[model samples]
Target: MVGRGTILGVLGVLMAACGTPQRQDSGSESVEGRVIRPAGLAFPYVKRPACPGEGCAYGTWLACDTVSVYAREADTTERAFYLAREEPFQVLAGAVHVTRPEVVVVTRPTHQIGFQESGVLFQQGDTLFVLDYIAEGFFDAWYRDSIIETEIFWPWEHWYPAKDYEYGGDVVQQGVASFWIQVRNGSGQEGWVPADRASLASANSLDPDPPRCPARAE
Candidate 1:
């Protein structure tokens, strides 16, 4: 029979191998890279301390305080997992479960696959603020209440073409019906054209003033 310790060791190895992650670009510059000091911050910025003692068990975590670790799940749920300053943990799957309020989790093997460094894992319970960079492709924002607000881009136009012709139509005389006017692509972009300036010939352009001529005898 396999011992519990052996099973745990094998599981840990498997997790370490498969759970390794690539540098996930959250599209946020701050979270996209390595952990660095927030500029203009004071010294001795009390980080959630690492596990001071050895042999700390999993789920042994710190309190919720400053930043936090959250996952946008497949079901579209944002769950927060409280973490300690020093526990190293990688996000495998599922919603985060937190006992303490403001704890961060540190990961092992530093920057390898399945290894995540100290992730800020505490929530302030304040109004969650999110900045969406539309240019950068953030179309939606997720809230703790599980409400997702999405933004869509729509452009407006002043004029639209009524018709479309595959090839330019035959050139017609200035006043001829077949002149510059031709059907355009229905789905094409809109552009404006002056009715009067459609053709250089007198026929195409409607005369501003009417010439009153007597009717010819039939």
Candidate 2:
């Protein structure tokens, strides 16, 4: 039979290889990385230490001091949003420089709301840039919400072509729709357009990453 020590040692190696992170505590070290989270899809970024109250942003995610969600799941109803710098590095949506050790991600609040301020934050050289680059390829991004008893017959728009990235066919949805990604620039300018008609990069422009990530099916 395998000894307990041997079994534990094997488990440790497997966890490390899978990149399972250890728990982080407060006042951890700061991290930095290049904002290589894909150019086409806008990323949701917010400042650290968000406050809750009447002044808080709308909706459920950022509505409280903590970052918990009310999604339907048995074993995973609420997950803690880490305020530490190291935690965000694990869930970065895009690939960063393989040479940069890791994407030392920080300020990843549990909820992501799309606005002009949506983009990943990273340090490139001495500059602090907020990248709002939208991908060139066109895909259907849905904006959905439920209607209560009084909200029946509410006018809504659905994507007909869905490829043009245009919304028309104003009608009512029976159930509800999911959240949609709306691009906003650092200057507070907003627009929802096709890939060809997308607004310019929100801040300090980044030269397109040679070729896009082939693995990204979206």
Candidate 3:
């Protein structure tokens, strides 16, 4: 439960919640489960849509059986933040705790989960309109309906087009292309395997996306 306070003051209230359940782990923060709703904040609107069938366009929100957990402040360059399962957090001044990792745990009046690590937290806010940004940006720049099939008829001449494009003139562009290739391949394969193929097995198991997502609904 996010602790009670005004929207502007909730930020400071979170800091106080840090030391509430005073535990003495050298690196662990305090966790006091004080629940409070933000003043004038609207109640959460919960929606659960069925999984898409054969040709239905995938909805922006996906379902999750377990609470979704992520590294706090993923946009930041620092990598020191990570949250634990059942970790308590505040959203719109209400406190909600994740019961399991990687599942979608719905908390209202915010109707979303916040991954808190150290002093920072990360979650989708309706105000960001990030999905619109992604869709627009993807279609505007990255999306290509037509397949770009480049036949390497002259592999000998352009086997390493990237090098030629960047440093063929004189300076060496360094060998980060290998890193990028690895990243691209890794990202494409980053999904859960079917339970039959994996060590765990369950029918109601969740995918990587959050369940009952309220962020992209606007």
TM-score of 3: 0.13
Top-TM-score structure, candidate number: 2
- Every model's Cα RMSD, please? 34.3, 24.9, 23.8
- Which 10 successive residues of model 3 have the least lDDT summed? 175-184
Write candidate 2's Cα lDDT for 148-179 as tens digits.
11110111221123354322112211111112
lDDT by residue (tens digit), candidate 1, 161-215: 3446121111110110100111111233221111112111111012333222223
lDDT of prediction 1 = 0.19
Off by over 4 Å in 1: 1-82, 94-135, 140-218
Model 2 alpha-carbon miss at residue 192, Å = 27
- Which of the two, 1 or 3, has more TM-score? 3
- TM-scores, all candidates, are 0.12, 0.17, 0.13
- Deviating ranges (above 4 Å) for candidate 3: 1-76, 92-218
| Candidate 2 runs further than 4 Å off | 1-81, 84-87, 92-168, 174-218
